[model samples]
Target: MPGSSLALLISPRHKVIHHDGREVPDPTKNKAVMKELGKWWALLKDKRFFLLVPVMVGFNWNGTYLGIYLTRYFSVRARALGALSSGVAATAANIVWGYVYDIKAISRPTLAKSTWVIFSVIMLTLFSW
Candidate 1:
């Protein structure tokens, strides 16, 4: 199949690095298995991943409920349209929020306070409806 065969033509020209500043070993080359495992273990021990557990769980739970609601209340075509619109809206929101959050001129404390205010307003508006 063309889909399966197309992947064979692609190759990474550069070395990959882990988030914790470790270089990822190329699978094509022989390396020590225990050293690689140690790197992975170090990454697993990072506190940041654990901190995101609740957020990850909530996202998945919300998505599951959204899927159920869509299927229950919408026709096939309407469901597809709703999914596309939701995806586009989410992307646009992320882009706008990224721009707001990345404003380098704003002091971190000011930005954090503004973000909290905006978030609170949005959440209150949403929950009030």
Candidate 2:
């Protein structure tokens, strides 16, 4: 996989040491499918995971609809442009949101709630229109 290859190229193969003189074990050292599945199950049991399901579904539904609309209604050139623009816009949004989420001025919970409110307002506006 590209991700594994990139990790191999970039990550240190030896033990990781923190500035506070603590040694951290490499996460990639041990590989167990059953253990991974157990961790996945634990995550699935979390209330946050259940809450995130609908949000993910809505985002995926909109993305699929947008893709279908572009392919069905636009010419090849137009569709290509649309796809490129969509990718660029998504990338830009991710970068902007990453910085916004990392702001030290606001509390994490406050930031999370504000983001949810903004998301809900946007969704409502789009769907209502």
Candidate 3:
């Protein structure tokens, strides 16, 4: 449900009619629709489009856990620094992975499987420490 809010943010509205078919959207509404369409169009043109959502989800999940671990296992100052460092690391990793996906045309399944393997390895290492 992490990305579920996207539906609310970008969902299209539909009109229902009794007898006749639904009328076309108002010009004002069409403007908003066109703007949203343009944004999507731009995204599609970008090479990194395929990686955006997955990287976002991965970063969010890892970031939340990193913050929690820092709070529980370290001093307040250390936790703060850890959080900052983790944020930078996650951002960099996301960008690199995105580039890899774009340049290599990696499939989603392969990306997902690799993500799990990497996450598991990281988790095991962190837990052992």
Once all C-alphas are superposed, what RMSD does model 3 give against the true structure? 13.9
The C-alpha RMSD of each candidate to the native structure, in angstroms, is 6.1, 3.0, 13.9
Each prediction's TM-score against the native? 0.54, 0.78, 0.38
Candidate 3 per-residue lDDT over residues 1-129, each given as its tens digit = 879877777535454343577655654645677889999999899975664555556657766877787778899888878768877987999899788767656787788778767765665565566
State the lDDT of candidate 2 residue by residue for 28-122, as single tens digits: 77888899999999999998777566567767877888889888889999988988998999999999999998899999999987887787677
Model 1 alpha-carbon drift over 4 Å, by segment: 1-37, 106-129
Best by TM-score: 2
Kindly report which residue stretches of model 2 are placed more than 4 angstroms away from their true locations once superposed: 1-24
lDDT of 1 at 26: 66
Candidate 2 has its poorest 10 consecutive residues by lDDT at 8-17
Q: In candidate 1, what are the lDDT values of residues 44-64, reduced to their tens digit? A: 899755645554555576688
Q: Best lDDT goes to which candidate? A: 2
Evaluated at residue 106, the lDDT of candidate 1 is: 96
Residue pairs in clash, model 2: none
